[model samples]
Target: MTDAAARGLWITLEGGDGAGKTTQAGLLESWLRERGREVVRTREPGGTEVGTLIRDIVLHHRGDVAPRAEALLYAADRAHHVATLVRPALARGQVVVQDRYLDSSVAYQGAGRVLDAAEVRELSLWATEGALPDLTVLLDLDPAAARARLDAADKPFDRLEAEREEFHVRVREAFRALADAEPQRFLVLDASRPAADLAAAVRERVTALL
Candidate 1:
């Protein structure tokens, strides 16, 4: 591989719960592996042992967690995840297909929880030493639709997913605003579309990066 190609790429999938991010991420990872590229598929809040513990508290804890405390927990997970997993994979020239990142924190904690969005973002940046994805694919879907998908799946809701519709609405708006502010780095797509279509669009973007 060329020097630039050997440097690796970071791609993050961001969206509300049940937005098909996992489906798309799996497709992207498969496509990249088919092309003989090393791919590290991981997710925030549960990407490592430390993160898994944090994930249980933030996502599965039965009781309420203070907004700031929740955000801090996520940031702590991000710090460990990036330092121990993401950065190392990238340094080895492996594509990191992460399920979520700082953006999710900004949307869920900042917008949904009514915390300061900028502060949440800054906190995440501090946690990760300013690490940012090369490309962020946002699966834009209506809150109601996403909720319906979750309901149809017959799965239990996590703490965040169990929130009210208005909370999810705020999260959707926050994600849109974030994508608008950084158009160059985000590839926003309609998540209501077929999985194949979404995967194709994602692949087109990643193909250019490759």
Candidate 2:
């Protein structure tokens, strides 16, 4: 990033599977762009080439991988993404919005996957070189409702989607617990609402940040 390039706001959306983060990330990116904010919307696992490869192994591996392995893989992807895309973009004053992040690893792999949160955070720091989001918008919703929506939408279940109902419930609660612990950094929202309403809520929160 040069002096002339813009600085960036790194905003990440965190939530359980089927929580509509992908849709919301897209909508938020468009809103930021419309307001003349340079934006780069991306996701974990497949942002950069290296990260993409890691994502495939983590997401589509034939056999089950350990929780630590899964957490490290996500951290690897995050490291590449931040070094290649996120950090530079933020340095240039772009709004680097992303779907999923280290929090997912901590909640899903650590708490949900039964890995230690302390270890997960340490690994994430190594992977991302300790880059933290300016704000984390956690789309809070019941795991049952999220699964129901995914089933209703007729989307194929991914590996994470294949977890037990109780697993997802723990993951969602972990996210809520994280937000509670870091109220200043989190904007927890009810993800059960209609899309338009959810989007509106997200925009309002982000607008204040801007």
Candidate 3:
């Protein structure tokens, strides 16, 4: 395969909060680096300086934000993130491991917030120029267990995280549905498993891509 074909492996980790995506992402980054691969690790709504500001407003804002506006905020951040951070890094043949992507918007804004899923996805696709991850790791978990993990963290919940259990349930279901729709691009795993096991599974799948 040519360099362009062999490199620029865009990978994303998606799931509800407290599903251990951050931990697994760290482990995946370290593993890739150990093998002499260039890895760019980032998160949605806060990957770049501009995105960080958006993250605060979207996640930490006290007042209610209209569902459509919230979705737009996420799309704006995604547009900037892909244009500035993700695309450039991938052009240099780096592995872009992202915490969240358009899938989150579709699940959270579409299903949880009762917006149109197709419309939300279409907006993100337009914003990001239809750049899809080569692989998406979905860490599936029960909302109750996810909430328990978050509660143990002892930190204040963010706007989306503060939503009711029913909302999170819808989000989880939407994630699973998305993964099922595109099995070729997604590896759905039970987040209730041991972190090491989850990391191993992620590594195994990613190694094949590498």
C-alpha lDDT of residue 32 in model 1? 94
TM-scores, all models, native as reference: 0.98, 0.94, 0.97
Candidate 1 Cα errors over 4 Å, as ranges: 1-6
| Model 3 lDDT tens row, 3-121 | 43555888899999999999999999999999998889999989999999999999999999999999999999999999999989988889898999999999999999999999999
Q: Point out the higher-scoring one by lDDT: 1 or 2.
A: 1
What is candidate 1's lDDT per residue for 78-164, written digit by digit as tens?
999999999889889899999999999999999999999999999999999999999999999999999999999998999999999
The clash count of every prediction, one per candidate, is 0, 5, 0
RMSD of 2: 2.5
TM-score quality measure for candidate 1: 0.98
RMSD of 3: 1.6
Model 2 regions more than 4 Å off? 1-6
Model 2, range 153-207, lDDT digits (tens) per residue?
8866778888899999889888988899989789898988887898898888778
| Candidate 1, residue 156: how far the Cα is off, in Å | 0.8
